[model samples]
Target: MSDTTRDGLADRFEENRPRLRALAYRTLGSAAEADDAVQETWLRLDRAGAGEVDNLPAWLTTVCGRICLDMLRSRTTRREQPLSEINDPPSAVESVLADEVEAALLIVLGTLAPAERLAFVLHDLFAVSFDEIAVVVGRTPQASRQLASRARRRVRAAAPAATEPRGRAVVDAFLSASRGGDLGALLELLDPDVVLRATGEAARLDAQGERRGAEVVARYFAGKAQAAVPALVDGAWGFAVFIGGELRVAVAMEIKNGQILGLTAASSPAALAGLTVTPL
Candidate 1:
């Protein structure tokens, strides 16, 4: 690289450094490891150059995520302790998400499978679309959503809900509102940007491949959830639908801050077999 080109590349990397560092820190849950991951990303970018990386920020995030995943796997193999806050100054992302992302939550994240960790942190926290997240985690978008949804359930299970309703309570409320066809109540339970995903039988019943927005989602659920009852889907506080007392589908949810952020309906028989569902 020429001097001018090299300088320009360096400047670009510098500008994106904060985001990269924050991504690494959250993914790794250790300041030292995060720094190492960020450095490695910059080194790779230096070798690849501007032409090879079409979007610098996205490229940096993907590379850093892979590096963090590798590190996490290695740590797991070594039987290391769970991640702890390393007392470093808070990055901009951390400062902004401080209330949303707690220290105890980091410990919980550290316990999740590395792929689940990456999926949850990347998609749920950063709002990286499942398509982009799938590229980083080497999974299809649907599978990536499942991984994040699973990880999210664990996070919710570990959380205390003294201040607001969460977990099964929220799902039950949604179901009751849906069964009653109460559009107003359904809208209140869902986030404005709530997303609904369905597969197999549920998709056919709802014709909702993937829908978003509170209004659309609320309308879809109005007079729906008739047979879906509160249940433990995959050991999480979720819901399941049965036809004539046979398990037909499972509803995996992503509830946060007392609102339904995402709802994924698993209706494929094979997929249901893989999941451990039980009525509540």
Candidate 2:
């Protein structure tokens, strides 16, 4: 294509960039990943000229969806790192809503399988037709509807519930305090009657016992859980400790009203397999 034609195509793509980024953000929870997906979409459009497509907006949306679907699928095959582990700051391209509804929606969406997430986000949130969604998920229209239906049920069942902002914030703070050996910070995050229980490998390692009282629990976790990462354990916010890329221990906590009330550490293979632990 000539310079004028190429420049015109670029202008059209730029016009749809904001919406494209939004589609990607809802499909994949991370702002950084969404920006990457949008950039990939632009690259594809640049290489495959827009002459063959009539509806540029719809075409760009589809391309971005497919890219996000691929990324979601790849998460299962990799030892994924949370967005917090990245060295760079969060992307500015994402929309930030400082409401409980937006935060809860993203948390609930994180629990869904990749296909189910893509199906539901595209059809329900963006009003994309099932036919168009099917093209992205590689399923028939009927199957895509089923995926969305299943996702919808899960979302509804979970709508009235969510991992609260305080839950994640406390876990992050506790982890930071523990890693830094800051006993004072740890005590501040724990309740006066805080308790810690252990099982499996942790038990065999003598890290087991019911320790009560904030000072006791705080001292135990001080400078501990060094290899832990923020994760969702058994539907709540927690941490998974890894040693050389292998999950060695998983800690599930019960936080009530901004305090860390209780924690259970498990390390057996069977126990770990049963827990649905994902990045927070």
Which candidate should be chosen as best, given lDDT against the real structure? 2
Model 2 clash pairs are none
lDDT of 2 by residue, 37-139 (tens): 9999999998888787888888887899999999988875423234344343334222333243454556667767888999988887778899999988999
Q: What is the lDDT of residue 154 in candidate 1?
A: 69
Model 1 lDDT, full chain set = 0.77
Candidate 1, residues 175-215: lDDT per residue as tens digits? 99999999999999899999988877666544547888999
What C-alpha RMSD separates each model from the true structure? 13.9, 6.8
lDDT of 2: 0.78
What TM-score do all the candidates reach, one by one?
0.54, 0.60
Q: Residue 237 CA error for candidate 1 (Å)?
A: 18
Worst 10 residues of 2 by lDDT: 89-98
Task: For each candidate in the order shown, give its overall lDDT on alpha carbons.
Answer: 0.77, 0.78
